[model samples]
Target: MTELLPAAGLTLADEILLAERLNEFVQDREAFSDNTWKQLLSVMRTGSRWASEHGRSFLPMSRADLRDYLLWLQASGRASSTVSTHAALISMLHRNAGLVPPNISPLVFRAVKKINRTAVISGERAGQAIPFRIGDLLRLDAQWSGSGRLQQVRDLAFLHVAYATLLRVSELGRLRVRDISRTADGRIVLDVAWTKTIVMTGGLIKALSDLSSQRLTEWITLSGLIAEPDAFLFGPVHRSNRATVALLNPLSTRALEDIFARAWREAGPGKDARPNKNRYRGWSGHSTRVGAAIDMALKKYSTAQIMQEGTWKKPETVMRYIRHVDAHAGAMVDLMDKYASS
Candidate 1:
């Protein structure tokens, strides 16, 4: 193959290196897949093409070039948030340029503050734990069945474990059968070796064990999951002959989001619970995880204890989920009254 020309000192080989770095970052953070890296590369290529057609090939790109490319994406009907992904990728390219910026010292700056949407809502600038409820979860269980598809049983099991263990959709989707251990009584136990949260100190990070072991066992036995350990715990719901095992691929994260959207619709809204006009305030698959956290909190589990079940490293992330469920707002008042009076 002919060598691709360089853009901002990134040859096709350098782009590959950056893609590797992107993969490591995503995997380490338990984020999206390698496909996201390809999207970022496409963004770079688009910017390079614009520059080339305009006769501005240079070793380092100007901020103007980046801004123009972002404008192009916006004009193409991308959302502000999606356009921001391209901006972030471009920023990473500048950081990886291997040369220091003019008059700037080479020093690393750690993330002192990540975005805290929950904190903003509570009239504070700190992250709030997302809130989730058991009722909401039962409703989601119903929504999974609404698809009326073949893998309905398998999909239900997947949704149950996700809600019961509060697994991030990414963790839930990536689970291999080997990641689960079966107890003598035939219960399913999950050993989540990786999670989205970062534990800087590292030794003895908390985990969820057998949260839904009993239910999982029932689901597996009913679904006839006798596959080998290396098989995917969840796969697409398709049909096949006896000679070929009909296997399902892991659902994409985007697909999971759509599932939640469908659930929110089926659950509908309380008569007076409109978030804005016709829009309902709180509902989604994320509700599965956040709702579990809120249920535990309302059950009087301490904040730290809730973090253990939710597998949240920081109280802040847990707090975000807490706030999401707090949209109803009465639970906290009762919680405060009971605790404060005590």
Candidate 2:
């Protein structure tokens, strides 16, 4: 008896069965974070709808179909990066289905290139959040220190820890009480289990400043969460009738953004100033991470040091956050000043 084999592999009784199993394995192995998955799903849905409207199928979409889709996206006022993501998502779908991806089409490539050139010529770029400066954090801390309000204490702790660790709002939201520990040096260390980077090596450790640790301790004591080790570190605070803290539930990303917005408003000049309408309009949950990177850059930390602290695998990503700061305080600025002033 002779054994049948697939074209690329060893002998198998049924090649179709092997292909099916391989497809399933590939699908299972490709995992994405919740937010990332949602974004990819959105892209997929948009692409699929476009394909359906054009009487085309997504699995074996042709290069011409993809080109048309890209043109459609551009016509619909999608950003170049967003259109690129959609193309990438379509390519991923094709690859998962064991078909050659249509991403290498010259027309699609030219479309993307044209969009980039147009954006640069028009001075268009993505909006960035205003980094939360250290001075702002200090001012907020002073105001919340003697307020004797549980929510204020929690906000103070949140702001300090956020600036210290540069944690994303999602990672901060997932923090559990048990994930934190006090070091012998009296600093608070957080064991970040879920982050965008550390999915394999268990997790990474981030340390909080002494002031942040003290504020955290006060919040925990006041919130009565010291006994509940399994509770979330940051939870909801009920302010309907009276201020009451809830620890059993984890804080949502929206809630974190609201907290940051409120802090920005309070940190500004007047009580009537609207956070969304003010200079702090772009400030959001990601501001802490951007601010921390800029702070490190202003302090003369090397690129490698900033990358390590931010847990960024790519130097280019880190550069994006600090480029503006570098423009003001970089070595070139000092050199230029020395020559120009003389």
TM-score of 1: 0.57
lDDT of 1 at 49: 81
Compute the lDDT for candidate 1: 0.55
Candidate 1 wrongly placed segments (more than 4 Å): 1-39, 45-59, 64-84, 97-132, 139-150, 183-187, 197-211, 239-249, 254-285, 296-318, 324-342
Model 1, 165-222: lDDT tens digits are 7877877776766677666765566766666553334422222235355445544554
Candidate 2 lDDT trough over 10 residues, lowest sum: 1-10
The segments of candidate 2 whose C-alpha lies over 4 angstroms from its true place after superposition are 1-30, 240-249, 269-282, 328-342
**Shift of residue 106 alpha carbon in model 1, Å:** 15
TM-scores for every candidate against the unseen true structure: 0.57, 0.84
lDDT of each: 0.55, 0.76
True-structure lDDT of candidate 2: 0.76
